[model samples]
Target: MSRLKLPHNPKLLSHWEGWENATVYSTEGNSVLVQTVDMITPILDDPYDFGQVVAANAISDIYTMGCLPELALNIIAFPCSVLPKVVLSQILAGGQDKAEEAGVLIGGGHTVEDDELKYGMVVTGFGTKDNLWRVGGAKNGDVLILTKPIGTGIISTALKAGEATLETINIVAESMKKLNNLPVLLKNHKIKINACTDVTGFGLMVHALSLINKSKLGIKIVAREIPIFKKANELALSGFVPGGAYRNQEWASPRVIINATPAKMPFDPILLFDPQTSGGLLVAVEEKNAELLLNILKEAGFSATSIIGSLVVDKEERIEII
Candidate 1:
């Protein structure tokens, strides 16, 4: 993005300066329009499941910005000569179902023939200017919360190696298909969220660094408090780690500091750097409202949600993992 000579638009909001998604104020200045596009190839065997996960992943960017998805356009690539037409239909059906679940309409899209199959979406949504959530609003006394467990990258590597059990594959698939819809929960409980972002191609550490860096503060994470998928640690230890995990670690090496590690931990610290697909939202809320927000998420069936860490006034380093 830095290399590109992008135009200067006065309507662009500064709050979304470093955010992955882009938001602009409407001409009327009453609401803000949020827009984002994402795409990913098949991670699982079932085309339907792959479509569901990809759709969820693409739409998550809007949710991370605290906006409700309203419209989407399908982005597809497939080899018509190699794969049967029915496969494409099932994939579209799956995407449609998931989009509808998020109250978004698939108005139209573009498709093309390619050697390998791929699918995703471009989603748009709207929210009031006053309610816009930025990634830079975390305060010194804010508490960090993650809505989903990590390790999709590890589990995916295991599946490709034919070492993952059917049960494990099922569990990971469901997690990836889950949507990061915290705005609904927050509104229901009348809670105000300070900062938020979804964990995706970038691992938790990288995303956490993005949060604190924007706020010009530091954070301390409780390594053990972080939620992990079943058997993810074991799989990661067995050399099932993805290439993206290594890249993430290398990119965050200079900014992250390891304070301590528990003696009984199963996985190495590298697991903290594992990449994720359709991952959960990392939210920062005032310390006083942290517990109540967590309980609300739990009651709404977000079992993996937990208070992983807190922001500190010290800006010595972007993150400290203990």
Candidate 2:
């Protein structure tokens, strides 16, 4: 949609800004509002778990913008006739619980009868005029840190095909349920983040590419340094890759330069383009602050966080996989 020549307004700070969070000036106030709407079908068999995951996914955009998520409205499409009311209640309860955990309020929402069930929220967050973050803020020699591991897409496909183990499902579920709350956690540390974005449907490759698209900087990703789920690599080797992974690879291959051989990477190269659900934040910080920021993230219980790559200048390719 960013490629589309859509209408634009001066108050829209993030218009046509790829898949980054949207920021707009308040019509009646000086504050900037970060908002996004997202929905997803059931990934987990339990309705409650599905609700929690989707809610986290919905509000993640606000966190990506370095804002506090304060308000949300539930969006539900359910088969009322097919499922009992208790199922619906459980789903709503799950969403409400997750919202409370994120310090957000579910004031109200809209629901419509449908044959298939879908759930999500429209999240609104706030930040000061001077603190808004953008995908294009990466600078030369900036360190790139990923907050969570990749490979959920492949594992999800495996689960659907009955090729995944119970342990794998639980591992991926825990990762998906984890909130990307680094923005809120950073207030105490006072670290300066140069760029930020949540890895989602576009996968890490496309999301990282967005960071340098508007600048002269290029990214060098250390394949071995990247973190992955315990069973994701083995599953990918067995042909459990998702359709989105193939699409992401096809879209990102031309722009990225791959330097590492398949033998050197612990996981399949396709996993680099595996789409994630409620994934972690990919942040760019100055080299001096990189270790400090990484420590802060780990202290906040983001154990999977790792320094995966760095941003560079005077490079012809948009991204280089080393």
Candidate 3:
């Protein structure tokens, strides 16, 4: 369905790279421009919250590429006749506030009438060559760091099923609406990022697997070390898992070797494949800097950040849960 004819140019670094979070173009001055677009249907009950989540989700790709978001254009589809105009205005206002918080300028956008409402953004960011990170450059011995807790998919499912408590709803909403500014924070602290990607619909395991693509490297994740919301585990055990989680498990099962069980929590390990909405960054940093990076994230109020695993030279497997 794509008529995308890729151009052959030396400055276009992401022309042929597949499965990247965003398209990156290098400049003659040793800088790079990143472009990405993403959209999603209503994930929250509040229209404003949904707008915020979508905006954060869309801009995450640019942040994952270690770029500062500079500009954005809105993309909206609304049921103009059915829903009140106030709802649409709130959605735009929410998106605008979130974008402005990221220091991005929303020049303009387009909208069309529809039966259901949808919203997203096309974001462009800028970064220097030295600070740019890619998903394929994870080195052996580099530590894998997850900047946020997992299990948004299960929580949201539980919410829809009327099983989620107010506390749970509040927790997941706060997590999803938060921005992935780790790259910028790390750059300011002079921390080096070897590889990175945002954990989105493909879930953590699939996103982590992308880092080792076409390489002899494999990631070994400590099952207990991976973060998960306690309520999500209970919801998952109660048969509230999303379809995307199962699909992700099926897709990664061939290359993934599970050396660990679901343990006492039964549903804990399964969360590794649970699709997240606006999830955290899966960062790969040098072994020595791993502790400092984790500390920095925590100091900046990212308390759920953890060093879940590390890259290893294992040609037989792409990922291992142990």
**Which stretches of candidate 3 lie above 4 Å from their native place?**
1-7, 264-268
- Candidate 2 has which clashing residue pairs, if any? none
| Clash number for each model | 0, 0, 0
RMSD of each: 1.7, 1.8, 1.8
- For candidate 1, give the lDDT: 0.85
Taking the tens digit of each residue's C-alpha lDDT, what string does model 1 give over 1-322?
A: 5676665677766433465444544555668788888888788888888888988998888888778889999999999999999999999998999999989899999999999998989999888777777776888879999999999999999999998999999988998998777886677676678888888888999988878774668998888789999989899889999999999999997888887756634467777889999998999999999889989889877899989999997656478877
**lDDT string, candidate 2, 242-297, tens digits:** 88999999999888888988776666889889999999999999999988988888
Best by lDDT: 3
lDDT string, candidate 3, 66-139, tens digits? 89999999999999899999998888898999998889899999999989888999999999887788898999
Candidate 3 to truth, TM: 0.95
Runs of candidate 1 with Cα error greater than 4 angstroms are 14-17
Q: Identify the candidate with maximal TM-score.
A: 1
Give per-model TM-scores.
0.95, 0.95, 0.95
Error of 2 at 90 (Å): 1.4
**What is the lDDT, from 0 to 100, of the residue 184 in candidate 2?**
86
